[model samples]
Structures are given as C-alpha cells and as structure tokens.
Target chain A: FATMAPSSSPVHLLFRQLFEKESSTYTYLLADLAHPDKPAVLVDPVDQTVDRDLNLVKQLGLKLIYAMNTHVHADHITGTGLIKKQMPNVRSLISRASCAKADIFVDPGEKIHVGNLLLEVRPTPGHTAGCVTYVTGEGEGQPYPRMAFTGDALLIRGCGRTDFQGGDAHELYKSVHTQIFSLPRETLLYPAHDYKGQTVTTVGEEILHNPRLSKDEESFNTIMENLGLAYPKMFDVAVPANMVCGIQDSHA
Target chain B: FATMAPSSSPVHLLFRQLFEKESSTYTYLLADLAHPDKPAVLVDPVDQTVDRDLNLVKQLGLKLIYAMNTHVHADHITGTGLIKKQMPNVRSLISRASCAKADIFVDPGEKIHVGNLLLEVRPTPGHTAGCVTYVTGEGEGQPYPRMAFTGDALLIRGCGRTDFQGGDAHELYKSVHTQIFSLPRETLLYPAHDYKGQTVTTVGEEILHNPRLSKDEESFNTIMENLGLAYPKMFDVAVPANMVCGIQDSHA
Candidate 1:
C-alpha cells in the first residue's frame, strides 16, 4: 500500500550541512528555502566545498544572499571570495574589527536581515583577532536567538588554541565568560569545526564541561602553556588562502 | 656560597634536539654521550632528520647502531632507508609484522645488543599492520624495560584509530591488552607523534584510562566507526614514502 502525508502548516526550515576539509577544519551552509526568495547564508565556507553548496542551493531554488566567516581560520582555506565571484549579488560580510578585507564590515552589535532570518554579529576575538559568532533568529522586538555560529572561538568539549595571531588565552577567557556563556543555555552552539565528531552543542554545556575553558585561572594557565605546541597543519596554506578570500591562482 | 661538589658518577649528561619539517612533524634526538662509545637509537626518525642524526653521531664520537620506526606512520614521511644509507653499519629493526620492508625484521621475543645497551622489540600493531614497540634496557636480562618507543599504536592519553590498512579493532584490542598493557606500570611510553602537547606517558596510565582504548567493546567500535570519516592527510604521501623505506624523489 502506498501512503501520502500532508502537513497542516508550512515548515520554517533552518538547518546546516557540515563540510570537512583538510582533516580538522569544518565549513557549513545554513539554508532556509521555505520563503519564495529562498535566501541562504554560508558560514566558514571552504574553497573546495563551494561546488557542493552551489549544487544544493540550485537544487533547492535558494538564492545565496550572504557569505560570512566567523574568523580568519588557520586550519583550512576559506571560500568567501569564490562564492562572491560566482554569485555577484551575494554580500561578503566579516567583522569590522577583523583585519581581513571584505565587502561589508559588520559591527559587533549590528543586525543583518536575510529573507526571513535575522543575524546579530557578536565579536568573539580569542581564536583570532576578529572572530565573531552569528546569532540567528526571526527579526522582532524580543527575538530569541536559537542558534549561534561560534567559529573556532569555542568547540564541543574544548576550545580553540590561543597561540596564533591575536590569540590570547586571557582574552579567550573573557570572550567565553562574558560574551558566549552569557547567552541562553539552550542556544545551539554550531562551531565551524569539530574534530571530536560532535556537530553541535550549547553554550551552557560548554561553560559547565568544556575541558579547556571550564577551569580555574591556574589550571587555565597550565592548559594554555601546554597548548603552545598544538599547531595547525594548514596554518601556512590557510592563512594565505583566507587573505585573498580563498582565491587560488594558477601557481596554487 | 660555592655549590656542592658534583658526584663522581659523571654529570649525567643529557642532550636534546628537535627536527621540524613540513611544519607538521617534530623528530627529536636525546642522548647521554658522556661516554665515547655511547650507543643511541633514533626516535620517530624522519627522512629529513637523517643529517641531524649523522651530525650527532659524529660529534659525540658514538656509533649509530639502531634505526627505529614507532610504527608504519600514516602522517609524516619515514627516515629508515635514509639512515640505513648513511650508516650501513647500523641495524634497521622494526616489528616483523609491520607490512613495510626492513633490513632486519625483529621478533618481539628476541633481545638485541647495541654497545652496552640492550633493546627488545615488542609487537604492538594497532595503528597499522606491522607496528612494534622498542624497549631499552642496560642488558639483555635487565630486570625492567625502562623506555618504550611506541610507533603509532598508542599515544599519551589516546590510542591510534583502527580504520586504515591492517588497522583492525580486534587486533588493536589484542595488541594493547597483551603486548603493551602487560609491561610494568612505570615503563615510559614514548610515541612517534604527539599533537596534544604531551611528550611521553606510562603504559599503566594508558591501559587504565586511555579514552579511545580503555573502553567496552561497544564503545571501542563506536569510536572507531566515528574516526573513519577523517582519514590522515599524509596517508597518500606516507604509504608510498614508507614502502620505499622513507625515500622521496623530487617528483614524489
């Protein structure tokens, strides 16, 4: 027997697809094609994973409205420029405090509207100088953010190392304690990359149990001291790649 | 105000050096060369680290007697062949079960002499098909094996993933259960690679609490299944490099 089911109400879908590049870095595409305009946001997008994102957008009849980077990643190459090149109308947004060059320099408290979705830029500058988490919700006077794109600033069971450019453990401590951890406990924490196989977590969960960040000052100092040795494999390649918006010249 | 006179048993000389290549691998050399005939073993020796090994051997007036692989590595390239080329008198030994070719296939049951030092080979093939652990002591019948050079089988707090060639979880269980775990609790475990900032650990510590291996069969299976998603970046470059005993032609 064949079965057919119909929904009573239209689903306001908001979901993400993970794309792992190199071994450790993860990029994501968050789409909401329920609206006729079908605007989508690309977060921490990788250079090699652009085709998959493009194909998915075309298949779902979604318009790529925004391409954003949570931070200048040191693990894998970014694809912000490539997407902008392909979708000329799409806006390339990055934290204004970040040293990276982009089309739209978003301030910390500024809000951006993409179709029916609203994103508030929140600066989280521990992992990199201009790291930011994109808070997503429906635009309203009392909007409650349901999801946060936490780049490399925070992870599932751990946090990003603070040994690279503008990486300050003490600053990271402040970023987590005052900025991220202050958010709603149930807000889903979607990091750009997670090597432990965990796709998502919550800010409250991280505050209570993150092995690296949930520690006393002395213990945090010890962890940070030891963390000096954990260097990324793609630092040399990814830094240069992210600088030009993930552009690969003929030599590359 | 003068410092207490030093003991007559020499200065207990200790020398340490590191080899950094491709920004991913760190090859180390440690030796007590107070004695002219001091015998030394290369740890996690890479093909490019050969020149430093040769320099140390010459400067110390010591004989290069053993070249070792922690395991058939899947990350950085190996240096077994290059060392053999430079020091033909030195013996190239690894676990007989390792699929890679070696000049002298070592059986775990046998003990070999290197000047006044004794080295025992232990089969521990969890990371790859033919991995081995080299235990060092003063003599063949030494009461305790002091140092263990674990190739890729085990790390400080974590165990290698069993998803690559000859990487069977059952075999890893057997290898860890019988071969490595059976050693004295204090026996120092020195791994081939450590990205977590730890340089060494003890077998007793690992067997009792290694997050990856010290678990039930179901948990072990779950971890291994999850690890299958992210394969090593150097697997393609490393297999061919190791097959030819770590040699890399310019084209390669």
Candidate 2:
C-alpha cells in the first residue's frame, strides 16, 4: 500500500533489483539519472558475487559513482574491492569508526551527494563498533530520503548480535532508541541481511515490533544470551577480508 | 531419550573440535586408543581448520590415522589437506564415487576397523554427488550402528536442497527410501549442522515422520519449489575447496 509514490523528477529514478546470495548477505544498487552524470551507489556488496551487480549496472546504463559498506560482515566476504577494481573511478567509502582501512572514511554526520540524492551517515553502533545506517533523501527540508540502509544493526523481525568484535548490547539499545527508531513512520527499512523470507520493512513497523530492540533491557539481554549461534566459521577470514575494502588476497 | 548404549572395551574416545573460518564449517575428530598403532579416521574435516584437530589428537595421546569427508560441502571450506599436512602417515578416505580426490577410496559396502569399532560407509548421495553416511559400532555382529554421521543428507525435521550440483529430487527420494530408511530405526542421526535449535534425531523417527521426505513425489517437488532457497554463494569456492580435500594453494 505504501508503494504509491511517483518519481519527483521526470527523468525517472530507476533502482536495479537487489537481493541476498545463499549466505543471506543483501546487496543493493540505487540510481537516479535525472541529473547530468546519472550517479549510482552500490551498498554492502559481497566478494566474488559481483558479476550480477556489474551486469545490472551495465544493463541500466548508469555510472557507478560510490561504493559503500554498511559495516564489516561476519557470514560472507565483502565485495568493496571487487567493485573498485572493476570501476576505478568510483570512491570506496566506509565508516571512520570501523577498524577496517578504507579509501574514504566517512564521519557519522557527514553527507554524501550522488546526482541529486543525498545520503546522511548516521553512526548506529550496536551490532558492531563501526556499524552505520545510510539515510537517503534531502538532509534538510525535504521528504526525499524515503529509505534507510540498515546493515547488521537491524532486521525485519530482529537486530544484529552484539557478541562479536566491538559488539555491545548496550550500544545497540542506544542506537535503535535514539538514531533508527527516531525516523518517520513511513520511511522504508532495508537491511544488509534477512534470513527470513521477507526483504524489507517500514520504520514504524520495526520500531514498534522488532523482537530484540523493541523489548525491555532485561528481555533484550536474555534474547542475546539465548541466541547460542555458533561463531561464524568465516569470521576470522571475513573480518580481515572486509578490512581493506573487501579484497581477498590471493595469498592468506 | 534414545542415548542408551553398553560397551565392554576400556577404550578412551576423544573428540576434537575444528571450526571453519568460512561458513562456520565444523570438523570433528573421534579417536579410540584401542588401536593406538593404527591411523585414526577424521570426520568432516575442513581445509584450514585442522590445527585444533591435530592439537586435540596429540593432547589426547593418540596418533593420526585417516581423514574422511562426509560429503562435498556447499557452506564452509574443507580441511582434508591440513590433516594430511599434520600427519603425513594418515590416509584420506572418502566415498570412492565421490567427486573428491582421496588417497584411499571407500565403497558403500566396505567396512574399516577403527579401534574396537567397525565403521561402515553407506552411499547416501542425496545431499550432493557421492554423499555418504558413516555408521560406527563395536564388533561385527553389532545389532545397531551406535552412531551415524549423516552429513547433510538427513537433518532433523528437514532435508538437504536438491538443487545444487548432483542434487536431484528423485535421487534424494531413492536415498531416503531405499538406503537410509533401511537402516536400524534406532540409529542416532548426527548431522553436520543444525540452526533450528535441534542437535540430533533418530533414523526411525525421520523415516516414519519427516514431513519433506515422507511425502509423495508430487508433494515433495511442490515443497522444494516453494521453499525458494537461493544457491549458496560459497558453492564455487566450497566445491573447489572440497575437491582437493579442502586445501587451496595459499596463493590461490
């Protein structure tokens, strides 16, 4: 019912389809060609699975302007380097707080401009110390940012675990309460991974019903303790792989 | 409630825990001192995760003997090489018909002596091409297989996807109906991974009531289609990794 909005610009905004691979890591490409350059952004791409992303970019005839990672991933390899390797002109960006070295370290309050769209970086460090959410739209006095890219910080029915490196449950609580849940009810929520079948959700819906973050602190701690998820086997490999913009060194 | 068994040998059995850094692949070591001079058999070993496996073997005061892979994995990297590296005296054994290359190939009807136990290899290639289940018990006339390492062929309340390489619904039908179902119903089913809060199941229970495999062919196809799982991202990496016994050239 909320998918009734028409593009504000007559040039048309085309969002190439985005989805997760077998590992449940979500990747997205957003583009608007109304302006001169027709810039686009690739979000949370997975390593070695860049063929689809590249193919989509070519089919859409859009210029790759920015490649961004929401945070370091635990389950799969990141594709930040692969994109930059294929598209040399695109800038690779990640949060400054993230321990991984990046070409462009983004500040929490910094604004990134691509074509006419503006992405406001909101440091939401609960799932990990460097976790961030990209709010898309006009930073001030505009209803444009209709969506947010929430990496491991949030999910449709749950939130990211705070047991990994630099992960803190308390920080996650603050992030959801202050930064993410503060968004407008109509804002669309797009996460980096969704193990469940559903892909997207609304800010209002998540704020009111997210199983982990919406509950009291006691319940939240209990949930975290009871998760019992085995440490991802690839964590050691994936963390370092993502540190340098998702590049897999031929030699480990 | 089915974990009742009686044994006469004073053999000390040790289990070593090896974790895959990618896709959380877990390899285990089960050894018995009764056959100290002979080689021990490794189960579901991953490529890079063998340090702990070897360390545990030495710490338990046993010698390395053999390596075994339950099936070609689609999730984590394999560790067959690491085992060989640590103990060159150890011979790697896998299903003879499996796509993997091994030092020693085992047939379905063949049985290997491990300490006081007899290990029987059962060709249950439904989860992947050459997938096999290992049944271990003491003595030749044992009434039941004390333990069954089912790999991905049979999971509690679920079955492996019949969509990947060598994954065939019809083949899975036969594997479940004729091969695995014929085993003693009381045999313990030990799967490779379990994410749904389940750790174990029995052969009798699965054969009698598994919702997916127990259904007729038409219903099974519809269920597989509707499940709509994407192909694993690690399929390419995992296949190649498992091919040479989970070893990738450091420079690969």
Candidate 3:
C-alpha cells in the first residue's frame, strides 16, 4: 500500500538501524516525534556496541526508556544489563516466557508506551520459547504503524532454526503463519540478524518469497530439521550472560 | 637464506598469525618444535579473542607459557589477564620500562627462553614509553634469528603515531632505526596492528618503502605532527584494562 510515502511526514517516528558487525547483530532505536528526549525502545543491543549505542542515544538527544531484547541471544552478549548501568532508569525488558530475568517481564498482546508511540508486543516464539515481534503503530488506525521488529523468528528470506535453546519447528511454523503472516501485507519486517546485508522486507514479499515458511507444514518442518546449523562460537559465554540480561558475573 | 627449508628442522619455530577484526589487531602465536609442552609465547592477544587464542593453542597441542605485549595497547583490551586464568602456567610479560604491572617484567638485552628458542628483547620505545622488539633466535649462532616482533613501533610501511600515551616522534624514529632496523636486513617484521591486509614485512623492504620513518628526524617529526590521527574508540577502557592485563573487574 505504501507505493509512495508522503514527501515528508513529521509524525513518521524516529528510527535508526545500527549494525554491530562482530556478531552480525542489528540494534534498533525508536522514538515518537515531539519528544526528542524520550525514545520508546531499543532492540537487541550487543555488549561490545554499548559505548556506540550510548553515544548514538546522546547524539540524538534521547533519554532511552527501554533497553529491550526479542529473546536471549547466543552469538553475542546483550547490552541490556550494561545499558541499565548507564541509563539507570531505563527498564531492561524480555519476555517472561524466556524465564531469563530482566527488570521488566513483557508478554504477548501487551502495549509498550513511549511518548505518543505504542509498540504492540506479539509473542512470536519458535526461534526460542521467548521470541517476540514488536509492532509499531496501529495498522488500520489513524496512527498507521507499519513496521514489525520480528526478532529472530523471521529473516529476509529465511526463518531462524529450531535447533538451539528451546527452539521448536512446529511452534515456529505455527507462530509465523498465525501471528506474523496475519499482519497487513504492507507491514515491514526487520529481523534481528542478517549476515547477507539485507535490511528490510515487506510482509507481502516475505509471504510470497520466504522459502522456508511459505512451504507446506511437512516441508517446512523437514527443512528446519536438516539445516545442520553450527552452534555459535561464543554460545558458552553468550547464553548464560544473556539469561541475566547480559551480566557476565553474579555481582551484576 | 631459506633456499630450501629442511624437512626436519628442530630449530624451526611454528608461527601463526591471527587477526581480531574488531580492532584490526594481529596476535601472533609462536612455539618452538624442540619442546612443544615447555614454553609457547603469544603476542598481543585481544580480550575478545581470548577463547580464540586458547583454542589455537589447544588445536596445535602446544602448551602456552607466556602472554607478552610489546606495549600497552589502546584499541582493544589485552587477553593477558584472561589467558593467565585459562593457562595457569602462562606468565604475563611486558617491558620493565613500561612501569605497567605484569607477572614478568623484561628488560633490554634480556633473553626470553622458550626451550631451545631464544627471543632477544631489545628496547624499542617511542610508540609507547616501554615498547620492545623481540627477535626470535641467534643466541648461540647457527639458525640465525631473522624475525623481529616490532609491535607498534614499526608497522609494515608506517610507524605508530607519537601523539598519545607518551608517544614521541623523534624517539620512535631513533628506536626503529637503531633497535629494529639495525637487525639483520633479512629480519621479518611483525606488527601489532594492520588496517590493511598486509601482514609481514622484511626490514630490508621497510627501510626502502616505509613512508613515514624512512627519512631524516626533522622531516619525520614534521610528518608525524601533521597526520591528525583520531583517538581510538576504546582508548579509555582498553588502556586501563590493558595496564591491568585485560581485567574488566574483580572477578576476572
């Protein structure tokens, strides 16, 4: 539907996509207009990029309110715990189903408030039991939120595997078809990790071209079973640290 | 003259070059074939690459005995502290002139013994107050040492900046010429960091091709002063952490 956006829209929302190349992770910063100091959320902040992220926040004159994650990561340590130390008031949030402790436990069908913006959280588990999709704005309403932070549940042309942690192919397949594909065909998808330099994909494009998920149930499950994915290099350190929201030690 | 390297050369040292792309830093691992389990020294291990360094040691089935740094680094945290934790027997080493704390403080003209392999330490300051060049071999003649680990004092074709942390252009010029260049013309030079992919350079090549240091003191100082280099991103965290051998906290 967005064949051509308005020449300019003051209410379009502030968004920035930052890349931490070490782990191929993308961190997103979002804020509503009219309040430069209040950025509603940050998604998937990596540990090594904490300084970079903090500098970006300062550069944009944002008071970061939420340092959140879609799920516990396995490739790199999360910056959630560290960000809290810097932004003391910013809540570190993760899905309660993850059972990975955080300052705030969010669940499906919840609304996260940031200034005039509202992120509707939808549980899109399958990559991990706690994976989530954060949708910005109201799809059919006056606000017209068209973007979705799909975490690791869905990528540009491929979906995350069901091999590590509590990943399940059946749950993942059902989740994508139900919660994600049900969104308006125009909704934009932003995945957590993209090694291939792909940035964004529209719901319509993914529905028509997503090879893994666009197939039948048996074919999708079989494909997930045979991906033969390699465990991440820093899994030993990343998972445990991410469980506590990126705290490397007990003192944190 | 390596016209034909011997099939069974006991005196030959096994060398591997590892790159940590985050900081464009290169860490070298050297092990003498005579006593593989005795002493293997690692140069410039980055904190994030600790696991990688240790894994390389294990993969080669060699025992690590020393973690050495030519000078305190500014770009990335050193893995010396973390390496000590993993390889309890590995001694942390640095130039005594550095005044930086380490398990072993080496001095100029001293010999760092690794089985039959002898690494002669030569004071090569100026990039930092306590930089040193380690020339592997030639303590007892036969199998002449032709390699010098010049650290940041002498890069492939350019020397390090003399702007921060007690860097001196004049001192660096003299040090490179006297301590590093004075080595055998065939001496192989290994640097601490390389932004480009170029790895090893011979002293003979550097003398002719080094753009920054192959000139008189007045011209060298003038060029150094006008380079206008940027401060490293991890300067604060890295310098302090490296001083303490990459220890981020009490737990480390």
| lDDT (0 to 1) per candidate | 0.67, 0.72, 0.80
> Per-residue lDDT of B136-196 in model 1, one digit per residue for the tens?
6543334243767776677766677788768887777788778778878767776665553
Estimated TM-score for each candidate: 0.47, 0.48, 0.50
The 10 consecutive residues of candidate 3 chain A with the worst lDDT sum are: A1-10
Instruction: Give the alpha carbon lDDT tens digit for every residue of A177-202 in model 1.
Output: 77788888867787786653345666
lDDT string for model 3 (B1-252, tens) is 244333223454666666677787878888775553545889988887888678757755688888999899988888998888877888889998987889899989998877557788998889898899888866443244367888899997788888988899889999999998887876778889766444566787678768888788899999999998887789998888888765555473
Deviation of model 1 at A194, angstroms: 1.0
Question: Could you give candidate 2's per-residue lDDT for residues A115-174 as a string of tens digits?
Answer: 656678999997999999998764432334377899989887688988987998888888
Judge candidate 1 against the unseen true structure and give its global Cα lDDT, from 0 to 1: 0.67
DockQ of each: 0.01, 0.01, 0.01
Q: Is the docking of candidate 1 incorrect, acceptable, medium or high quality?
A: incorrect
Model 2, B108-199: lDDT tens digits are: 87887666556788888767878888877644434243677888887766788888768877777777777677777767677776543234
Which of candidates 1 and 3 reaches a greater TM-score? 3
